[model samples]
Target: MKQMTLKTTSDLSLAIAKDRFSRGTLWRFPARVPLLLLVTGLCLQMPAVWAQQQETPGKAAIPQESPFGTYGSFEKLLQAAQGGDADAQVKVSLCYGKGIGVTQDYEKAFTWAMKAAEQENAGGASIVAGCYLQGKGVEQNIPQAIEWVTKAANRGDVMAQYNLAATYYEGLYGIPKDEEKAFFWAEKAANQGDREAQCLLGVCYLTGKGVTKNLEKSAYWSQKASDQGAPAAQRNMGIFYAMGLGGLKKDVNKALELWKKAAEAGDSEAQYALGSCYAGDVEYYDPDKIYQNMPEAKKWLQKAADQGHERAKETLERLFHIKASS
Candidate 1:
């Protein structure tokens, strides 16, 4: 058996904020009612009801009743939002931004989201920051986005903290790359029990980015995030176990198990690593299973290659070329 050298690799975590919208209410007026009359009645009553609701913005929005039972409705939600309900305001913002029950209106979404943020709602502030970042319903303003995200992070919003950390790390949207600030924000989110941040902090420790290189700390944070079912963390832990680095005992079986879990979760890197192991690239590991199952190597390698993994692509090309020639 040929002894193969393992490639040293590091996982760099990138955080991307995802926007999610809430469902809208489903209400239908009786067909017997004149459409004009129904619209007129709603217009006349909605403002007064909205004004009453605005007086207590802290109140939770009441769920609308429908034939399907309790559900969210755009009109009812907007009414509650106008009444000063932060959660409702956020929901209305989502509805407007996503065109849930009304026409897609970025301006309206920005207005409602800003209103919720003004009330010091963490989620609302995060959404506002995301909107500013992406120019979803407002003009793209990096400074404003950073300010709103900072507020949300200060309010202990884990995702906001993670976003801020990534922003600092990547120097995105005119933000200067500052590893120290990145580490600081990542630590804050990690302390708040954000698994992504924990994994990022582990990477930071391993790379000595804004901190001293410490394998033990790397292993510690990676294990913490791994225990939370973070695929990236699991993959990193698998690498550590395989290489006996980060104060972990070398355990090929454990490495395989972790890689399998991460691979199943669609992690291309883990798929590549698993493929490498199956191809007998992991030094000192048993090669019997791998030798008996070359197709398994190709399967995992193909999966990784399909995801645009350069190394996997190179390996697979070389592998098949050699097989064809033989």
Candidate 2:
């Protein structure tokens, strides 16, 4: 039987961030969202309510939702917020924070978010944490940010849980990497149905980080996330089927099916995998003539190599004697 190496933790972190952007989540804390780029991995991007679900690559995701929700106007939203509607208060905060139907005012945003938080809104606590994290309307305080986000996570905010997990995983805020806490928060968000968190949890299980290495559990989470169109999980599932890991029988066709989905989603590694599969007669690389087409191989390999995937470039150079510019 043949086996392929799993992605390193940092590479997987990059994939997780890509997945967040793929979801089309939008938020602004005065400027760019705060994400620590450090040696300890787990990349994270905050998610908010403004953006729509992503539909296709290279296209505007979908129609952005109105910040006012059913109220249809900022005035109506503010009125509702003043009336102590926690959900409306959160929307009002976004209106101020993002300047949607209101002037950009981080102070007002913080105030509105605090009102919602006082009402015990989980999402509102997360918003307040972002304020502290970015120093948007509050003094930058990592401790306060962590405290607020932890509150949100305890209240079952999925994004807050995912963010907390990434923070601990990356040892952000100068804290030591705590794999146990990372796994704890990741499990919370993954179980609450976050695709990125699910992918992270799968990788954690696969690598025995904060848990025993359990291929079956890894496959279970990967399959769930892949079913939700997570490209990273799709690629992982493709490898699982290809190598007969996690109780799966080796099935090249099944592997191609999964890899094609991830490749179309713009995963360079998956594109390389697909191109490699379509190339002719490499030992332990692919099945026989059932999946050979040089044109398809070149097309996918070029795409991967364009993204600077070394293996794709090497394969194109060695097998087809073609130079792929990086």
Candidate 3:
């Protein structure tokens, strides 16, 4: 088996960040939406009476209900929030926070979210933590964010758990680094089927960080997250299959299958692998199985190139020059 090495964009970014933060240990945070849903329900339970109050600058006084019922408008949602509707409050806060269908205003975002969080809304608490953590309409306060995230995590908010695990993993803030604690929380969230946690856990197993180096465990967790449609996990699984590592038998067919799935999902690594497969004369690359004549290699390579997969771009350039000269 030939081992082909490819340069990845993330590798370059990591290298740059490492060089910059060398003297000072910068924690890598992996918080995603999966870790924030722990308080989702609480954020959805606020009273709906406050829905009528409009807090934006120079916005029309919108009606509570759009001309069509169930038409899905932020104005109605805000009205519902003002009416003390918890779910409406969460929706409105998100709208304000993200500037969706309204002007972006973190203060307004915090104001609405705080209303729900004050009521012990789990989702609201998580959102509030996010606001403080990112300084969205509030000061960037890691301690305060951690405080709220901890509250949400203790309540089994999956998103909060993920965020907390990420925090522990990165060891940012005044918090000391603790990989063991990170792994514990990640495992808890992964067991609950959190894709990000599952992916991170897979990486941990792969790198022997916070756990014994176990390729089998790495592939297992990666597969779990991959099945849930995580692009990175899908690409990693394809790599595992290709290398026959992590208890996976060398199955070029399986590798190709996974590579195709992930490539189509916009993963540059998988795209490059798919291009290689289609351009080859392997048994599985028979005309019937692979549309080799359809310029697949170019297509996949171009996709990977667009993603800054250096090797793919070089390959494409070489192929183009060869074709042009001929």
Off by over 4 Å in 1: 9-72, 287-292, 322-326
lDDT of 3: 0.61
Compared with the true structure, all predictions reach lDDT values of 0.65, 0.69, 0.61
TM-score of each: 0.76, 0.80, 0.65
Worst 10 residues of 1 by lDDT: 19-28
Model 1 lDDT tens row, 184-250: 9889978877676787798889888889988899889989888877777888888888878888888
Give the best candidate by lDDT.
Answer: 2
Ordering by lDDT: 2, 1, 3
Q: Which ten residues in a row have the lowest lDDT in candidate 3?
A: 47-56
Per-residue lDDT, model 2, residue 180, is 88
**Candidates' RMSD to native:** 11.4, 6.9, 9.9
* Order of quality (TM-score): 2, 1, 3
Candidate 2, residues 169-249, lDDT tens digits: the string is: 656667587888988988997897776678778888887878888888888998888888888889988888877878888
Across 192-213, the per-residue lDDT of candidate 3 in tens digits comes to: 7777678778877777668887
